[model samples]
Target: MKTDELDYTLPDELIAQEPTPKRSESRLLVLDRDAGTLTEDVFSGVGKYFESGDCLALNDTRVIRARLKAEKLTGGKLEIFLLRELGLGEWEALVRPSSRTKPGSKVVIGESVNATILEPTQAGRRRVVFEDGDVLSILQSNGEIPLPPYIQRKAKESIDTGRYQTVYARAYGAVAAPTAGLHFTKGLLAELKEKGLSTTTLTLHVGYGTFKPIQVDKIDAHVVDPEDFVFTKESASALNEVRKNGNRVISVGTTSTRVLETQYIDGEYRTGAGLTQCYIYPPYSFHGVDTLITNFHLPKSSLLALVYAFGGTELVREAYAYAVENKFRFYSYGDAMLIL
Candidate 1:
């Protein structure tokens, strides 16, 4: 498929700048693939579409305060966005003003953390080594939440610290949130459980690559960056049991879906932990997920391609067009879609 096939025109105003007042209050667009229909409802009422014994698989990866402000020795201000930890005090980071911060450059982060730029890496990133202290602790005091570039705000408000993350986020490693899970609240999860739905969590540390655009004209030429994921024995057993009983496995987001699909082998879920670059696009056969609950994704993105693969090309195209015409919000802090 051509990457241009996924393109859609979205008004700038419809890109969500802020979250809903309440998490569960966001609108839900239900796409019933079998029926070839689309319906709109409140996210809190999403449980009504599920049958008893259905499994809800969610990503529990927590977003880290990866965006840090720093100043070079020459007094040039720069932003260092932490991508992944390379261990031994070194990290792979995207340093803004990369032209200014060369391999030997030194920058000060707050009062306590000083870092030396080590080397340049692919895609305009830098290798940074921090001077003697816990980097995570330093981030807690001086770092800011790495909001997506589409959210044009001069400064992050207090609400962003909490609202940008899911209620169930636990394992802390992700630079970005598994956004599809953001609409869920504790009350909604409990309500689903009371309806005889079982929920399990796997961790996929969402990387900045999730927002990477498909630069290639042909979709098959695009490659996804590897992201680490953890699917435990307990979670595997729980989801496998759901399939054994003939229940649906509803993936909460693309991140969780990737982990499940990566670990599924020989017609069953397997327990494991590793990095996965499992890119999903149109014409791909899904082996793990029966239903998908996801947020509206950017046009010409790999994320949108995955949704097209799951929901069928023409149906998703119509659904996106309907969403735009109805003035539904878009992107991370936006409304959701349940593809059944």
Candidate 2:
């Protein structure tokens, strides 16, 4: 498949700059893949479409405050975006002005927190170690939320610290939030539970690579960076039971979908932790996740390609056109779509 096949026209204004006043207030676009149908409704009412004997799998990976500002030893300003933990006190990061901060360069963040660039790694990333108090605590005091670059706005007040995270977020590792899950509120989740809809949680630490645009002309040529996914034996057993009972496995976000599709084995969901670079594009046969709930992805992204694979290319394109026509929000702080 060609990368341009996933392209769609979206007005600059439709790219949401801020989240909705309420989490569940965002719009939901429902797309019937087989029927080629589209419907618009409030996200809080998503449970209306799913009945009993269905499972909603959610990504519970927590987003850390990963963006750090500091000064280089020579007094140059530096910005480091933490990607993932390499070990205790060590992390993989992307540094701005990478040319200046070569291996062995030192940077000081805040009053006492200092970091040393160990070496350059794959994809222009740097391995850095912090010599300070607990890295997590230091980040809480000095680091800022690593919002997607497309947002182009800073998190306002202190509430953003909480707003940027999903209500069900628990495991800590992700650099980015699973935006589709952002539409869910505790009340809405409880309501679904009351409807006899079972739910399970998995963890995929979304990396900064999620924001990287596809550079290859051919979609198949694009290689994804590996991200860690945690699928416990309990969660797998629950999902397998859902299948055994003749129910649908509804993935809450693309991250969860990737974990499901990648970890799914011979008629059973696999258990334990693993890394996935599973690239789902058009003409791909899905083994798991009968339904998907996802946000409006950016054009020419691997995410959009995955959507094109799940929902037909033309169908997704038409739905996106309708979204643009109806003024549905776009991107991370945007509205959602349910592909069934």
Candidate 3:
């Protein structure tokens, strides 16, 4: 498919800059694929559409404080965005104003935290080695929340530290949040459980590549960066049981959907952990996900392509038009869509 097929017009104001006051208060857009209908509701009432025996698979990857301020030895300021850990003190990172930050360049982060740039990696990323203390501990004390570029803020606010993350985020490695899971509150999840809906979790550390644009004209030419994921035996057993009992396996986000589809083989869920480069797009058949709950994605993005693949192309186009007409928020901190 041409990349243009996924393009849509969205007003600049509709891009959500901040999260809703309450997590469950965000608007929900329900797309009944079978009925070809679009219905709106509050996210807290999402359980009304689910059957008692249905399974909800959630991504439990936690967003880290990856954005850090650094000062070059020449007194130049730079932003080092940590992507992933490579070794005990080494990491894969993106350094802004990299034009002059060649190999062997050194920068100081905090009073005691310093780093040396090693070499350039794929897609202009750098290999950085820290010199002072534990990398994770240094990030905890000095790094800032890595908000998407669309969210404009003069300074980092305290609210973002919590609101940018999901209520159930546990494993810590992701640079970005599995946004669909952000709408769920602990109270709302408990309510769903009481209603007989079973929930399970897997970890897929959302990568910066999630925001990578589709530069190719043809959608098939584009490649997604591999992200680390883990599907444990317990989660696989629960989902398989749901399928055995003829219950729906509803994926909470595109991240979880990728892991489920990747681990699904021979008509059964398998336990595994590794980097997944699953690039789901239109004209593809789904083997694991019966339903998908996701947030509004950016125009001409791989994420939008996956959504279009799950929901029919024309149906998703109409739904997006409706969302724009009704002024539904867009992007990571935006409202949600449940496609069934």
lDDT of 3 by residue, 81-168 (tens): 9998888889899999777797988899988688998789988999999996488789899999999988887435678889888999
TM-score of 3: 0.98
Q: What TM-score, computed on C-alpha atoms, does each candidate reach?
A: 0.98, 0.97, 0.98
Tell me the spans in candidate 3 whose CA falls farther than 4 Å from its real position: none
Clashing residue pairs, backbone N/CA/C < 3 A, model 3: none
In candidate 2, what are the lDDT values of residues 1-340, reduced to their tens digit? 8888877788899999889999999999999987879999999989999989899999999999899998988789989999988888999999998878879998999987889987889888999899863788988889899888888788765656777899999988888999999999999999999999999999999999999889989999999889999999999999999999999999999999999998898878989697899889989899888999999998999999999989888899999999999999999999999998
Model 3 CA lDDT for position 82: 94
| Candidate 3: clashing residue pairs, number | 0
Question: Candidate 1 overall Cα lDDT vs. reference?
Answer: 0.93
Model 3 residue 179 distance off true place after TM-score fit, in angstroms:
0.4
Once fitted onto the true fold, the runs of candidate 1 whose alpha carbons sit more than 4 angstroms away are 155-157
- Deviating ranges (above 4 Å) for candidate 2: none
lDDT tens string, model 1, 1-340? Answer: 9999989999999999999999999999999999999999999999999999999999999998999999988789999999988887888999988987778898999985899987898888899899964888888899899899899984365799899899999998899889999999999999999999999999999999989999999999999999989999999999999999999999999889899999999999999998899999989999999999999999999899999999999999999999999999999999999999
Local distance difference test scores for all models: 0.93, 0.91, 0.93
